[model samples]
Target: MKELNIAVVGATGAVGQEILKVIEERKVPFKSLRMLASSRSAGKEITFMEKTYTVEETTLDAFKGVDVALFAGGPASRAFGRDVQAAGTVVIDNSSTFRLEEDVPLIIPEVNGEAAKNHKGLIASPNCSTTLLVGAINPLHQKAGVKRIIVSTYQAVSGAGAAGLTELEDQSRQILDHKPIHLDVFQHQIAFNLIPHIDVWQEEDYSKEETKVLHETHKILDAPDMAITVTAVRVPVMRSHAESVYVEFENPLSPDEAREILAAAPRVVLQDKPHDNIYPMPITATGSDDIYVGRIRKDLYNDHALNLWACFDQIRKGAATNTVQILELLLEKDWI
Candidate 1:
């Protein structure tokens, strides 16, 4: 492999740190690595791969000489994405700002990796829930021709970032002490609670998190007209995300057969053994790179329908690892 110049924007954030870890753990050959964050976080130093690097303030010029830039920032990602691409760097972004754009290809490499070759200097990683959802569903779609999907996500509070985690911990302590719970990171007290809302409401009263699943799945699978409905919820869990997915296929797909296919699917770890109470859980999937899938069973009403339960590290595979996978695809194809 050739050594390339790589940079990670928003290096101080959760997903950004994971991106660095993935690159290090995968032993990606890089001639140079740069870390950039906001001015507030600039000057911070991180030790990775036994080497220390300082985080610089992100700017248009920071992308200079970079071959591939992984972005794990917020809406600010759009600004840096344009700058990075203008500097001749390919940006693999982990934000919603670019996913719906016509020119940017929304990718889950395992499903539509070829789409990376179609990028106009930028590519998008899907939302966390969508990432895990597609990983477990794509194989079945290819085999049975999926017609409809109904999914409900149990997303961890960490999805809201560091503040969310702190808030949950504080709330738990407050509740245990019989004190008033605080609600800083969420609309309601997240400790020992579930918030059905994940993002701002949009058309038809569906949350942004819910709608992203519908659109991104279609684009990734090349099934623009497929029916996909999702409900995104924020739970008090610290890490990882879990989902209950119901899939209706065009062809007959039995539970046993679905289990067989999912077991052999790439990046999916099968744990379906209901009799022994073994199944995928957020706690078990906290640091996993693969999607843990189980609870396989046929829907009583439809012979072509099956229900699945899946869990995965929301920060790793969903954001950072997938972005790295895109870079790997570009590298393998010599696109970057």
Candidate 2:
């Protein structure tokens, strides 16, 4: 529990801001903190631990003397990851650029914490939807064995970053005012409608976001042969993302038993009760650290298939919290 020097790349973004807040909420022992962002965001001040720190433009030299670098930035990691690692800093990257790399481990401390122990100075956090889904699925897989997974996400606008959220708000205002709607952040208007696509469509007709869920789940669960299919849809919600997950297990499990198992799992909250209108919802899940799972029931057609609803704050547990948790684990193991 020794104090370590910490640096936050993309300190001005939604996820970066959450990382700073979580660091303070968790009272992480840090000897020093440096805020690093793009040149456009340089000179902006961010308050953490009761003091304001000005963000500096990120550069190769940013990692010097830094012990842990939390990267909520995007592909810019391709520009700075190696240099930071070479300088003896552990980079917890929140980007898709490295998650699939064979050498870079995609970690969710509660799931593949042991994999993080072997980090060669870089760890990747999975996609928001993928992270929460696996966080809920791993415990069950260990107990009953997950045979196949089919998921459709009702993702929040914030998953695309702050711009996406703003677009939703602005578009909502426009629609209410009978003004022309601006549909820039998404391929279609997202205010009163759902977009079936989350990211760019690939040759296989799956969006990039859908593909990430498929691959990331396999990697984190260490189940490369697990049957998984995903369809990501962008919803109008501003914060938390929800998923309708249908999982087929090798062994049949009662809903009560699955709830019991998930209740004990780390970072998962079970809120199942259909008749009473009790279930996980995005509005209720926002700003929380745990992923919420509810509406658990058995699928009618498949004997082993179970239906579930999962929700979590996309910017927190989905991104920043998981990254900070990895940092905590790294510190616990003396990896940073």
Candidate 3:
């Protein structure tokens, strides 16, 4: 691979820091790496891949001469996406701001690698939950034609950013210490409690996070008309997000067949042995790059529908690693 100048926008945040680690763990060849964050985080020193880099305040000119810009902040992506692209640098944004845009490709390299080539300048990474959702089943959808999907997501506090994780820790500690429980990072008590609401409430009552799941799945699967509904719940877990999905396909697929298909799918680890007590869990999924799927079985009543559980590291494939993968694709295609 040709060495290219890589820039990381929002390089100090949780996801941004994860991106830096991923780039190094994956051994991506880069001529130079630039870190950009908010002015508040500027001048902070971050060491990644055994090399220290200073975080610079993000500016329009920061992207000049950059080849691949990996955006880990929502506001920064919205603020600098066009600027970087204008500077002849391509951006792979891990933000929801452009996922639904008519032009930007919401890519999961394993599922939609070709879509990266069509990116005008910016490519969007789907929401963490959506990334894991689409990734777990895109292959199945292609073979069996997914008609309807109903999913309930157990998202981690980390999905809300580092502060969310800190809030979970603080609230849990407070509750244990018999101190007053505070609710700021989360709307309600997130320690030992579940918040069904994620993001703002939308038109009919579905949360924004759920709406993103509905829309993004349809788009990434190339089934814009596919009917998908999601109930997003914030679990007190630290990092990995888990989902229980029920999918109805046009063609009936057996549990054994589904398991076989998913086991061979890219970036998926199948551990479906209920009798042996083998299954995927957030605890095991944390810090791992692969999405784990298990409990593949045919619905008791509907032979056409399949029920499964999945878990993924929200910081890895869910956000950062996918962005880095897209950058690799761009470099390989000479699109950067």
Full-model lDDT for every candidate: 0.89, 0.90, 0.90
Cα lDDT tens digits, model 2, 1-336, are: 889999999999988999999999988899999999999999999887789899999998877889889999676688898778877888899988889898889999989999987788889999998997898888889988999999999999998888999999999999999999988888999999999998788868999999999899889889999998898999899999999999999998878889999999888999887788889998889889998999988888887879998999999999999999999998888876
Steric collisions counted per model: 0, 0, 0
Residue-by-residue lDDT tens digits, candidate 3, 197-309: 99999989999999999899878888889999899999999999999999999999999999989999989999888899899998888889998999898999999999999
Candidate 2 residue runs with Cα over 4 Å from true position: none
Considering only N, C-alpha and C atoms within 3 Å, which residue pairs clash in candidate 1?
none
- Estimate, for each residue in 1-336, the C-alpha lDDT of model 1 and write its tens digit: 778999999899888888998998888889999998899999999998989999999898888888888898586597778777877988889988888888999998778888888678999999888899899998999999999999999999878876777898999999999999877879988898889998899999999999999998888888998999999999889888999999999999988888889899888999999899999998888877899999998999999899989999988888889889888888888877
For residue 239, model 2's alpha carbon misses the true position, in angstroms, by 1.0
Span of 10 residues, lowest total lDDT, candidate 1? 73-82
Candidate 3 lDDT trough over 10 residues, lowest sum: 327-336
- Give the lDDT of residue 105 in candidate 3: 92
Question: Candidate 3, after superposition: displacement of residue 291 in Å?
Answer: 0.9
What is the lDDT, from 0 to 100, of the residue 4 in candidate 2? 90
Candidate 2 local accuracy as lDDT?
A: 0.90
Clashing pairs in 3: none
Off by over 4 Å in 3: none
| Every model's TM-score | 0.97, 0.98, 0.98
